[model samples]
Target: MNPWEVASPCTQRCVTRPTGNEQAYARTRRVPAASVLRRYASLTAALGSALAAGTRIADPSVLQRHARCVLGALGIGLDATGPLRVPGTAAGTLIVANHVSWLDVIAVLAVEPVPLIAKQEVSGWPVVGPLTRRTGNRFINRDAPRELPRFVGELAAHLRDGGSVMVFPQATTWCTAPGGPFRRAMFEAALRAAAPVRPAAIDYARDGTRSTAAAYVGGDSLAASLLRVAGTDGLAVRVRPCRTLWPHGHDRRSLAAAAHAAVSDAVSAPVLAPRTGVFRTARPPEATVPPQLRAHA
Candidate 1:
């Protein structure tokens, strides 16, 4: 059996599609067709402008500004809590989040722009591919299990060199909260580098209620998802950064469990069952304080 076969799996079965009535409701909230077109145009212009500037504006703040502009063009707003960038640490921090939509990458960038771990296919994508490469993001080939150890080692080296990286531990997109289990392989990088792990919870909402308009799940094409996001009004992404976890005296499995619990609690989502036998111990006692208590404290 392939070693990577033991990794947690997330398939099309885990995706939750909106019902017919929910689809109708989304349509009602959609902007005019022309508005969507304009939004796309604006997004293109923003990407083009950023590309034209080259590495001169490669600063994280500049990248963050560019991301915000892209979101604004799509009529989406961003609300983030906690420190987007951990301060005073020379060691790179591993930023982990639950995956929901393609927009998640941009949403996270808007708050804190950093190179991310993406699937290898993203490197071949039209504009996004070139942009990601230009910005120093790394990609992994999910089909090539043999290459995973090498990739994880390189990722650890990067972190040890003080280069931060963001990754979606869910490994794939889900339609809503309480998504798939957090894969443990990526956490191994954090453990190897002795880097701190920062867990963030991401979700979409509109009119103060959870919204699935931005979800990009099974069978959802990129073009269709983009159009859906552009057409939706009052769409906003919420990023809540949880307490940072240190690797001292903890194994990768415990670290993954603790991070998963932190993100799940932050989004008010129930914790999903872990893959059988993958987690030998319960979530570590160092798990983050519940968001509600943290808020009052």
Candidate 2:
């Protein structure tokens, strides 16, 4: 494993007092200690237990918590809440959401207690990819369609074994509400795997009409986006309830359409406020490695 380097580009020293913008930053500001410590602890233990644990790594919730803490320490925070709650369990499931920023993964994983499905390229990036793989994440090579089947098959077994997967249906990070058409690939994977699809809406807001939400979008890099928000006084994230969709035994195309509609409808809600303080449900399964998730059928 490579040494973990600082990935987020936040530069703001945690401000004690707020001047409008900083208030929003404070609202989301929460330290990234325990999550980070917990993960390292798990890694040390994993080294001793890797052989017994097989090729897959050990518990990664700590890494996710560490990530959230790191982002929080850097003045980045996410508040995800909804009247309609999505139950999280170790039970096999699939999650789909709109892509807002690369931070979307961090914010979601910080609060969401499950592994993720990211793009193939992320697995080869600098520090981020290493961290991603350490957490037992998988990806689809948009360029290599042939390998997708094997990946989908692996995801299927994961669902069958009661694991959960999260996917960004938008495929690319864009800032507009009702963004581009939801890609059909992962939707099909979930259908074939018989995993439920959960749609989450992610948004950014700043003081007044200053528009902090738009900073993370466009062709900007994730590091650049984080630095921009941290340097600013007030930037906030409001995540909507992830809309969970049952396959309904539908075809891939039909399921894709339904999934897209579900996500699109959820994003239609008025802008939401940020959620805080380790939002969690009780007894979320702490899946470390493949376990029974690597099924063949």
Q: Which candidate is the best by lDDT?
A: 1
lDDT of 2 by residue, 52-164 (tens): 33334326545555655655554444556532223443346677667656667766666565678877788888656666676778876666666766877888778766777
| Model 2 bad stretches (over 4 Å) | 1-60, 82-91, 208-218, 272-297
Judging by TM-score against the true structure, name the best candidate: 1
Candidate 1 local lDDT, 1-297, one digit each (tens): 443333333333333345434632232277898998899999999888778768744678788778788888887777665444455455587999988899999988887789999989999998788778877789988889889899999999998777889999878777776477788998899888877888988987765557777888767788877877888777777777887887777898999899899888988842232221111112222434333212221
Q: For model 2, what is the error of residue 157's alpha carbon versus the real structure, in angstroms, after optimal superposition?
A: 1.6
The 10-residue segment with the lowest total lDDT in model 1: 273-282
Please give the lDDT score at residue 78 for candidate 2: 56
Which ranges in model 1 have alpha carbons more than 4 Å from their true place?
1-28, 269-297
Q: Which pairs clash in model 2?
A: 21-233, 21-234, 22-233, 32-69, 35-66, 36-66, 79-275, 91-162, 92-162, 92-163
Q: What TM-score, over all chains together, does every model reach? A: 0.82, 0.67
Pairs clashing within candidate 1: none
